[model samples]
Target: MKKYLLQSIRLTAVLLVLLCVVYPLIVAFAGGFSKGNGGGEKITKNGKVVGYALIGQNFSKPEYFWGRPSAVGYNAAGSGGSNKGPSNEEYLAVVSGRIDTLLKYHPYLKKADIPADMVTASGSGLDPNISEQAAIIQIKRVAANRGLTDRAVAELVVKNTEGPLLGMFGPSVINVLKLNLALDELKK
Candidate 1:
């Protein structure tokens, strides 16, 4: 019985180490290879890399289409929502403050023109994409700021907007990094 108990303990330790440490390390290493040497490196133009696609970033300028509100301020390690219920005072305050800020920044727009994504932080808080409607909502502001025609900006937005994955999963979304890069390219 003593020998059997010792064998079981050794087996459990081995399995635990394999599952908790070795497996994850192997998977992470393999995934790193798939992403190339730079891993999370952002693609660039004019020798300037702008941002990563996996992380959300602030775009407060009128010339750029803004991404969703990030609860952790786009910190990938801190990916998570506020987890506040709809009726929570903190959540309501945040939403209200965002709306006010949006209004202040875009005084020319009516209340209805603002997209919900503009005021809401996404679930992961590190979402790099925004809804198509959110991108559309900022078209006029960005176009005017960049001195581009609305049609041109709209076309660019449409081009950057990615469709549902596998043509059936997830919503149509736009990567802010890619879209902003395209916008910068237009100026060059």
Candidate 2:
């Protein structure tokens, strides 16, 4: 019994060090090679910091493409979903409201044509990218609001569209923040 007790203590200590200390150190070291160097990727506008690349932000104005709706109100510190299922009454109402608002801004878009990502908040409520279809659907509203041609905005959307990982993993998506930044540059 005493020998077994000693063995258990030793194993526990080893696991604690490996899981808590060594694992975190390794992850931080690996993150150093990533875009933000262990921090969130910083996006800049007019040479000033605006937001992070991996997080979502609100762009309610008609002149910009909207990102996925965020349940946490785009608050990074409290990122999460609404925890409501598709059939939930409140959830259905929220989706309906989003669809109505979208239609008000873009009366030309058919109800069935609106992509799910446009009206639904992502699971993490922090998805920075939207489906290419969602971005394309909003092009007309943005172009008209910004006094730009539909062709030009569509081209920008095409230019910003990111292909699936390894050419086959996920659906094509466009980073809304990056797309809006490029659109602003085009205006200038």
Find the candidate with the highest TM-score and give its number. 2
> lDDT for every model?
0.84, 0.91
After aligning candidate 2 to the native by TM-score, how far in Å is the CA of 75 from where it should be?
Answer: 1.1
On residues 70-143, what C-alpha lDDT tens digit does candidate 2 reach at each position? 99988888889988987899889999999999898889989989999899989888899999889988999999
- The Cα error of candidate 2 at residue 88, in Å, is 1.5
Query: How many clashes in candidate 1?
Result: 0
lDDT of 1 by residue, 53-99 (tens): 57777777888988889887877777888778888998899899988
Alpha-carbon deviation at 99 in model 1, angstroms: 1.7
TM-score, candidate number 2: 0.91
lDDT of 2: 0.91
| Span of ten consecutive residues with least summed lDDT in model 2 | 53-62
